[model samples]
Target: MDTPSEPGQPTRLLFLGEENLADGFRLIGFEAHPNPSPAQVEQILRQLQHTHDKAFVLVDEALMREDIPQLKRVRREGGRILVMAVPSLQGPTALSSDVAERLAALFGTATLRSE
Candidate 1:
């Protein structure tokens, strides 16, 4: 959690995933962490809900299963941190993303796989 940014400062961007992705995100100015555990993710989300004015958090999709109660609560609470699941470097991910689901719902599943 951090103090509200000055009038000119940009909101923080955080990425939690494998080292390869973390390195790239760091190059682009995100506060990146490599291979964070589920507990750590919960802690970060909880902290963000309480203090920061706003942030962008990209999580390793494989690490977060939507069923976790803590995660569900954080999302439901409408925190300042915008949390999103992203593809990780660890093999193929079985996890699906909200964006993908929404796109499929809007355009139909056939359109998604057609590309």
Candidate 2:
């Protein structure tokens, strides 16, 4: 980890999404941004851009299509700050996860169960 303020500090994990997911992530030690506005999201992204520490930012799948220019630029640039899209806490939407499908393929239907 490397930063102007704190050299050799530990890498960070971030969860930028809704409140439902934020509380749980915060408890697990991730820096949580619950239901942030577009501007706030952009600001955070900009801040992360400068800090030269490896980090994982877990963004809600729904926010993947954010119209923020900074986010668009970050996605286009592709840096050490890894970004991942996860499902919302409210459950799967149109952008549903394929976890069930993958699990079924690996373990077979008899071993898979639905909620």
Candidate 3:
């Protein structure tokens, strides 16, 4: 689990997805990583989990399908990290229904749509 950020510190926003997705977030001032592999995502998440700052991670939903356990573990252990699985530029994956339900339950919102 990560330590909490100091009072008034800016929360970090990170996006992990494809090149186009990373580029889109980068244009909006967010730090983005273009990682399509689940192994790489797991490694990065492990490293980021120990940082003493608030982290909002937006990941490609498709990749999440390949490693649901890793994503679940991160959500279970990451105190200062919030992970959100979002659709890629190519659109939502076939696992959208399951992912959307879980995300909605986690965040208590029904605004997330696969389409």
Candidate 4:
């Protein structure tokens, strides 16, 4: 479970999931933020600009369905940033078929992730 910071300490990870899931991290012992929109993601990313201290950046694929292009762009210009798209608890899955196909076409590769 993740415990809240006392005063001055670095956040463990940058989470971009549903705000409701914040408790899970709290119970386990990690800090996280829930960002459910492209604007919100951009805002958070800008806020953390030049700070590569985040252990991870987690995003909900469903929430970010419309931002896959932007996400791909960000992913390509990678640094220490690790972006993952998780599925929402009570929503459609975030497999991103279109993005996956596009990626395959661009790279001329096989299935991105075979089942």
Each prediction's TM-score against the native? 0.70, 0.69, 0.70, 0.57
Q: 6-111, model 4: which lDDT tens digit per residue?
A: 4455545656768776557546664566555677777666544434344456666655566545466556666545666666666544355456768878975555
| Greater-lDDT candidate between 1 and 4 | 1
Residue 14, model 3, lDDT: 87
Show where candidate 4 strays beyond 4 Å.
1-11, 68-70, 97-115
The order by descending lDDT is: 2, 3, 1, 4
- Per-residue alpha-carbon lDDT of model 2 for 17-52, expressed as tens digits? 888988999999999999888898898988888765
The global Cα lDDT (0 to 1) of model 4 is 0.59
User: lDDT: which is higher, 2 or 4?
Assistant: 2
Instruction: For residues 1-115, write the lDDT of model 1, one tens digit per residue.
Output: 3566566657779897777888999999999988887777777776766664478888777655645555667555655567777776556544456677788789887665522
Listing every candidate in turn, what is its Cα RMSD in Å to the true structure after a full C-alpha superposition? 3.6, 5.6, 4.9, 7.6
Candidate 2 lDDT for residue 25: 91
Which candidate should be chosen as best, given lDDT against the real structure?
2
Q: Write the per-residue lDDT of candidate 3 for residues 1-115, one digit (tens) a residue.
A: 5565687888788888878788889999878888757777887777666566677988876776675566678776767778877776675443354556788789755466445
Window of ten residues with lowest summed lDDT in model 1: 88-97
Q: What shift in Å separates residue 65 of candidate 2 from its native position after superposition?
A: 1.9
Note the Cα lDDT for every prediction shown: 0.71, 0.74, 0.73, 0.59
Predicted candidate 2: what Cα RMSD to the true structure?
A: 5.6
Lowest-scoring 10 consecutive residues by lDDT in candidate 3? Answer: 91-100
Steric clash pairs (candidate 3): none
